[model samples]
Target chain A: MTAIHTGELVDRIGEAVLADPAVVRLDGGPFQTIATYLPGRRVVGVTAADRITVSVVLRLDQPIPAVAAALRERVRRVAGDLPIDVHVNDLESKEEPV
Target chain B: MVTTNSQNDLRDAVPAARQSPAPARLADENGQGKTTIASNVVQKIAGMAAREVSGVHAMGGGMSRAFGAIKERIPGAGTSSTAGVSVEVGEKQAAIDLDMIVEYGASIADLARAVRRNVITAVERMTGLEVIEVNISVEDVHLPDDNGGDEAPEKSRVE
Candidate 1:
């Protein structure tokens, strides 16, 4: 496989992770350490180095592990052999009455 | 060489998963990556489950209840669902503590048992965390007479 640019790969991984219904949004973990800084913008919740770290706030409807496993699979599709790390920073109650 | 070495150091400093005193029950680590569930998620689930019991009038101790009341008045300052709940979550198990007010007619012991069961079931089913114990503190009972004024506002106005 052709080597992909780090910035492009990070962006693609972010998109793929968000596509999962169980994910509420990508989260910047405590202290905002889980992120990738690009030239003009930064991708929150995804850092790619020796491994890829993706942090997220998930909807409470699904089991946390199942969602995380699904996310790892999704990231693998774009990230290739890089190990993926999923951090669940928070949970959003989607069904809670306003 | 220096830059690469520093990068490695930085990576090492930040652990792949959060460091907690207790093993995180909801965080599952495997070859692909690690998935961690925050403690607050368990707290919220326990709180919601406790509230679902028929006898539970409200959650939280006196101070928090008062604070919650004030908080509810503010527009967009939503009431906290986790107000009266605290949880200790481990790698494969969780313990919950709850403060609640029961209705006047309900039996406290029975109420506690029902709330415990509901909370354990909800937390286990939703997050897949095993609930080892649920400690419920019945802070107060809601006396029906306390709200009599609201029900008979016209009587007071006429008097």
Candidate 2:
């Protein structure tokens, strides 16, 4: 199978992860600062490895473990059989304004 | 690599593409040119949609609303409709995170549901980008008496 371009692969993985209703976003988190120092390292939380690692923030309403597991499968489909690292860095509130 | 039971479970959790279809990328190709929707565009759209919902008193949390309020006071700094809205826009899909303050007495569950539906509809219709999720964060509540400008006046000084 032809390997996808790194950027393209990243985009695809992002799409897959976001496709889930429970996913909030790929949280910028602390890695946001690295982009400033490392100009081209904009795709934070995504690492190019033999397998990839993905870290994200999720909506609080769903079960965290289940969401993380689902993400692994999603990431694998887009990036090939890569072992993804899913981190639940933050949780968005499920309740409305009180 | 050593795989654990949880990893195996995760492996099984990936749904089939047909079952959970990926969002279609927004494409404008006429063999002449193409158009793209910027992330900011989606952000603004989401913000507007949330604002359109009646129970939404304001966008952003306390500090952000404070800053947004201050920004509005400046001559050229028009109110930022996108203040509380953040988006992660992709080739075919976009995800939105909103921090909002609701008017008191509104049901949180019902309002969130309405806001999510409205935001998804508005963003998808306008941008042609499928909104995968709209995460709402109810940062604060806006009480009727909380309007700083509507405070009862003190005894007339001139009197």
Best by TM-score: 1
Candidate 2 has a TM-score of 0.46
lDDT of 1 by residue, B43-134 (tens): 87788789988989889988778887787787644457877888898656789999998889999998899999999888888777788899
**Model 1, runs deviating above 4 Å:** A1-4, A95-98, B1-29, B67-79, B148-159
Pairs that collide in candidate 1 are B23-B91, B24-B91, B25-B90, B25-B91
Encode model 2's per-residue lDDT on B37-144: one tens digit a residue.
Answer: 446556666887899999899899988788878977774343466688889977567899999999989999999999999999887765566788889999999887
Give me the TM-scores for chain A across all models, comma-separated. Answer: 0.89, 0.77
Clashing residue pairs in all predictions, respectively, total 4, 1
Cα lDDT over the full model 1: 0.78
- Best model per DockQ: 1
Question: What does candidate 2's lDDT look like per residue over A12-82, in tens digits?
Answer: 77789889988777754453421111235456655544646565656644544456567777876777755
- Which regions of candidate 2 deviate over 4 angstroms? A1-98, B1-25, B28-32, B67-79, B148-159
Give the docking tier of candidate 1: acceptable
Residue-level lDDT for B55 in candidate 1: 80
Error of 1 at A16 (Å): 0.9
